[model samples]
Target: MRPRGIFWPGVAGIASGALMLVALVVTYGNSPDYEGRNGLRETVEFYRDAGNRDLTEAMALVMLAAGLLFLFFLAALARVTASRSSLVLVGGILFVALTMIATIAGAIYAITASHTEAFVVTPGTGTVALLLLDVSYAGTVAAMVGAAVLLFAVWRASRTTGAVPQWLAWFGFVIAVLCLAGPFSAWLTVLLMALWTVLAGVVLVLRPPTEA
Candidate 1:
């Protein structure tokens, strides 16, 4: 396909990353610290506020959109890299799937905390919320692992055959390494991925891979 053919996908990829950043800002900008010693309590308290619950729901929707847009970018990547390997596609699919699951878990947490009065009145309900939060965190870890694999695949393909630039591949490789740390380094991964996705999008728009 011509560069023109990939242009829209590239733009969509840019949107995907931008949406992720937007969602992060919306959810975390004024949110309470849920990573503190009393993390569960903090989360429960935050969601107790109606505004916080609304914001969580909105961000969850945004995240879902971002994940969908990312699939377009992933398909483009597979084409440009000429990667027949199922792992490349699988990795991308895994990231989206796990991320969707994580987002749903978060949304459920918000609902549980806000709508279910018993969540605060009863210990059992609170425990259920806590378990949901754990599921969200685990999903994030698995998603990042999948993202790391996808990035590694890109780096490997770009080493010689893929149309992507070597520098981008190297950057992806580094990000993939960081991604291995999963939730521990997720913040850094988000920042790096935003940059990488934008750069990759630009490349695809400007210079699509051609058959040799």
Candidate 2:
């Protein structure tokens, strides 16, 4: 088999992850003290600074698109893996759902962050916005769990069906473990996930399914 449906999903995953990474780097740069610093008041100030609002909104939009693309990629992955094992399919589905929640929460936070004036004046609104942002972090835990499960599923499938290379499955396991380190390791997590996704996509595109 040529892995007919894998090409588009791989492309989508690569594009989605790359776009989000670029957006984050461009918007935040080297500044660790950008948005969500000090407290709700500081966060409001960060966004209220005029120049930051446009960038914040733009970044949010990019992330939103990335999230949508990731969903599509996950759906395709689910389809591809469905015949190998039901557990693997479920893992992909769970990953998709959890990621969607995280993405939506992040977008909401970005929207709220952009509206600096509204949150600045309305005391509690900033807190609410900050809370929403935190919700995304919470969602990441679930997403990581899903990623781990999916990786495990892939590992198991690879062992029997040769659906993916053993090394790729192992790499996924490593990435999944790194992802569990939480917000402190977020940068590493994102980089590893993006690399894995791109590599997986490329492999699926270049190799015949039967070859694996």
Number of the top candidate by lDDT?
1
What's model 2's lDDT at 21? 73
Candidate models: Cα lDDT each:
0.77, 0.64
* Model 2 spans > 4 angstroms off: 23-37, 79-85, 109-124, 180-187, 209-212
* TM-score for each model: 0.85, 0.76
Stretches of candidate 1 off by over 4 Å are 1-4, 112-124, 208-212
* Candidate 1 similarity to native, TM-score: 0.85
Query: Candidate 1 on 93-203: residue-level lDDT in tens?
Result: 998899899889867867666677766623445456667767877887788888888888889988867557899999989999999787798766866776787788888
Q: What is the lDDT of residue 22 in candidate 2?
A: 75
RMSD of each: 2.9, 3.7
Worst 10 residues of 1 by lDDT: 119-128
Residue lDDT tens for model 2, 50-82: 566566567767766776777667666655555
